[model samples]
Target: MSDVDVIVIGSGPQGLAAATSLACEGLTVLVLEKADHLGGAVVSAEATLPGFVHDLYAMSMNLFVGSAFYEKHRVELQENGLEFVVSAHPYASAFPDGTSLKVSTDEGDTLKMWRAHSSADAEGWQRLGQLYDDFTQVYFPVYSSPLPSKSIASAFRGLWKVRATTPPAQLLQLVLSSTRSFGDRYFTTPEAKSLAAAWGMHLDFAPDIASGALFPLLELYGNMRSGMSIVKGGAGKLPAAMARMIEVRGGEVRVGAEVVQIQTDGRKATGVQLSNGEVIRAQRGILTTTPLPNLVNSLLSKQSVPSKMAEAARTYGFGPGTFMIHLALKGPIPWLDQELSDVCYVHLAPYVDDLARTYQQAVAGILPDEPLVVVGQPSVIDPSRVPNPNQHTAWLEVRAVPSEILGDAGGDLSEISWDEARDIFAERIIDKIERYAPGFREQILAQVAFSPVDLERVNPNLVGGDSVSGSHHQQQLFGFRPSWSLNRYATPVNGLFIAGAGTWPGAGVNCVSGPLAAERLLRDTHPSKRAFRRSR
Candidate 1:
């Protein structure tokens, strides 16, 4: 009566991770991807020119690298050709003054980088490193596992240790502080401050938002401890590895199969109806990674989801859109500051204030005058991205850009079409970069610009080009992610579950949500195994 134990819809990072987990558990797993390719936004291509590889979305896999789920499956993924290329100088943020603050995997090098800006900040970095160690011991388990009592107990145990030493008020401040406030309190120089603010915007958080400090602390210090790395060839290798894992385990990963409907029988989901009119019945459950709106409207019928859940999905706050520029360079980006050429990821923000204003303007539905652009030269880390060792290819993601092709927020441009606007906006982005790296624009052999609309065309989950699926605002985060009712991946409908950026532990190519959902689903279907897992 049933074909597979679990049918995972979509082949995004989280979806693939979920399906892989299910398959590894010896459950019959089937992964359906609507697109021709398996990886969703993580796809790569020679969009600029032949021998030039570019990632549509450059999601850092540090979370995946550190995840407990990934550790369990590391050998399988690596065996399937998943290899990471690390940068000695991991990340940096540059000011127009030609000064750059860089972070290195070597603690001494990173401390020296901060010490140049402020001696106090160097000490602060050491303190932050200590705090990061403490936070990781407590929260990472919670971030990795299902929200069970044992997991919660681990979090409490870690918190109790911190409480014994640190004051309650300072601990609360550490928990709830904003990046801007946290930076201001700890570091006196703009260099150290800019580093904190730059990392915060990687999520939807602007510098001054509450709990925004968590990301910077986690990103900067944690990445320092656990260096960031790109896939050996391209970011696409990650999903390819996941698919390979499922296939080798005798599970099916089918592309070009669009899931049109979730077939529910009054109280439980039975199967999925594809757009091609084929029905695949599941013995146990259906796991979806679609955006909240599409899940409630397109997949499920009207009034199927409870009113509160439907309202929550309807009112889900999508974050600002992104604009990206891809280039196949004749040679490396000629930088005025030669130190910048070695760093893998660089944040091009004139000042911390400019970064904040850019976010504000994008939220108001307009392009930022000086956008916070993350210029990534993956070739710096992996030379395989170029045709020759001397030549290079790179991509830059301009975050918090308006999804709509309206005029610039600063009233600098007037065109209303993305086709007309993308090039001009790209020019502005190039101009900003050229200010720091003089011959930057001339290094391009071929260049392509993607407006917000172009992003949506590639990945529908990036609705209105909001790449993180939906916003990470306080009301819509953690236990209240997606919705308060649909929290732990399991929906109101029995035998139905969800995962991906739309769920808890929120955004990034991080495989957090997938395994979390898989663990829950595994426990639900095999109650006997649940006690066995709990015992472990």
Candidate 2:
């Protein structure tokens, strides 16, 4: 007899979403997590001090709470105790000149901030917001759904309506322009341009890359509409609630049950083998949430995946790793602009060119002198992160760090090893923060620095420590994600599927990949069920 109807391998947001969705569809689901604790990268831990909780990787739920999965299941999840907290100010960018640009939840306030910098950029922001509204109906659905999906036609229609008289090539170029190019066209101020450009680093997109404008634009639009949110107690609460939903719906979640291999026949996968030699068979199918490389190269034996397909999986481009630092502070960050203390999210990069150079340095295997930094002060919005009311917390991340450090971009440091580079880089990042937030270094009671290697060690899925799963460059995006063959979450081997950040819609806590995989699985395997879903 089969062990379960379906087996999900990994407990990341995507894996949890898929498992719960499948269980709600009345399938017997078993979720196996390699870690001792569940919630993969979304979980929070006391990395610095005993009472200070820190988000391991992803912190903001702007994407997660805004996702279709969350939208569909909000009531059910809220019933199970999923709480979120949001700030009035979305994010800010601080410059060396003691001037900063802020994005507020209130549009007029945001416009005023832009106006203070440049009236032309203020107009540009309004124009961009209007343009975003035109594309919202079409873009959101298409992005959160499978490619060659029904929503693609609607997107085309929306696009044509927006650019009725424009030539198709010009329209394509407009949509596919780089972040820097778009900034140049839209904004007059370097402040606005740099703010938008800095956002590209989140998706591993450099300034001049094609299709790079989307992230910055999307972040601005969404945060402008509804301010960014954080999980109430901790980031772990999200997936823990998902686990609860799955259990109440009659699914099982197992931690410390490491899946070592996929036992398969010549044509199809039969079941998974645990590290301890325990075998669990899947009656319906298997959703492999680990990276495709592990799935194709380790789990499945040779000849299971085609040679070329295996090569593609091996060559799957994982971009720059992030160096994360969490601090248990005595008080708030002392920003020169006191208004910044109220904001939770801050991007610290001098200019768009500086952000671009960081990416370039990362790809060239050099440590950035001034890495594109994101500092999140969740305790400002929700004080539960710290133990006492008197205490504060800071979450700092230096993005686009080379996974394998070949040299230091600053030329002040050498000895290219993350073990050595971790502290040195963290010091540099804190030094940058100290420049803007005087007394920043003094406020730190205790600090924990996690190198790219540290991230990889904790989560195997974050291979080489790339938080985005894979690079968001043109060659590996959209339909070409993971690989063209594995685009639809299906593999050559029957009953074996891949789903995760490596899939379409890429990474983030958005929970798109899992649900998309679930929908496709139902469409392909249970036609009657798909029809029923459609009818409903």
Candidate 3:
């Protein structure tokens, strides 16, 4: 008999979710992580100063709260010490002139805010909200179900049911529309348009990118209904809770165990070989949450994978990089519009055209003069993260940066390595914030910056510092994610599954990939279910 029924590599949310699911099913499972810490991108640390906790990468729990895994295991996970803090004002945008707009759960108040901009915009906002409601009935089911599966087919049938309200052609157009087009079609004012368009940058979607409308619509409407949530203390508590859940179910989670290779038996994954030269056998299978390139190039022997599939993995695309700045503040950010202090997140990009320019600049390997700065204020909702009541932590996400610096659009930091230029770029982000909130620099008790390169160093899956793992462009999403053949979370090699932000329904804290992968494995392992497995 093998040492364990299955061995899962990586302890990211996806991996942990998969392991926990399998463990709950009474299977013997083991999770291995390369880093000394367990959580992959969802880690928390005192990066800026002592007693100030910062979420190293991911912060928003909006997607997690809406996931099936959370629904099934909510009580158990909470019993294992998972808790969430939510905000009524999920997100907002701050203009340079000290004006702002936000999406609130109270529809009346939100409409009132939009009416202040334009009555036409208020009507437009309600119409968009209706569109959101109509689209999500199809979107959520299709997203949660495995791509190209019976469930996906059923989801389309459900879409067919809504055709009287939202025609198939209209829905298809909306799906393919750019954020800019969507904004123009819906709202009149730039403030109203940008309030939705800014969310596209959360993924790799620029305002003008095709197939980008869905994200902004989903985020804006979804957050308005559900609000934004964060882990009670820090993001690390999530993985810790998951690990406890796995352990209670007789599974094991180990840190500092770097999986170096998949020990294969011709076409089947037998086990994983660690960097320490230790091989742990998996009787049933091995699931990997590593990026596609690493999986195809480094872990598996070249002979075990078909040349075409290997090529696809090697050519898997990653989007523009991201830079992060975490601040330990003497107090909350003194926004000129103090109303922003209560909101969970504020986007500092005021115009969709500006977002387009910055995105194009980053793609062309130029450091933009003005980048989109996403300011996350977790302390606004959760106070347990700080040592004192007066102190606070700020999470700044600098989007659309180049992984390799070629030139600077600003023309000041050209030809320098990221190591030398990280702080300088961070200064530009602070300066951008200072424009909206004067004396912002004075509130900074301490600050730490993570360049794109630094992000990749911390998590290899975040290649090029593309925080969403890989680009979610139409060609690489849904059934074509990673590749057409590997879309079902199964692989060319039997018993070797792959899942992560790089898989279907890509990115965010939407802990779906892991559970989907586990579900696939479970179905494949059943004695009478083998015939149903898709051909590799």
Best by lDDT: 3
Q: What is the C-alpha lDDT of each candidate?
A: 0.83, 0.85, 0.90
Ranking by TM-score: 3, 2, 1
For candidate 1, the lDDT comes to 0.83
> For residues 80-148, what per-residue lDDT tens digits would candidate 1 score against the true structure?
999988777878888878888888889888888788877998888877776777777777777776554
lDDT per residue as tens, model 2, 156-256: 88777767544345446646989999899789888889998988888888898988987888888888788989998789889889999999878999999
Q: Tell me the lDDT of model 3 at 99.
A: 96
Per-residue accuracy of model 3 over 368-412 as CA lDDT, tens digit each: 998999999998788999999998999999888999899999888
> Runs in model 2 with CA error above 4 Å?
164-171, 527-536
Number of the top TM-score candidate:
3
Query: Per-candidate TM vs. native?
Result: 0.95, 0.95, 0.97
lDDT of 3 at 45: 89
Q: After superposition, how far is residue 445 of candidate 1 from its true place, in Å?
A: 0.7
Worst 10 residues of 1 by lDDT: 163-172
Q: Model 1 segments beyond 4 Å from truth?
A: 410-412, 527-536
Q: Evaluate residue 157 in candidate 3 and report its C-alpha lDDT on the 0 to 100 scale.
A: 85
Question: Where does candidate 1 clash, by residue pair?
Answer: none
> Which model is ahead, 1 or 3, in terms of TM-score?
3
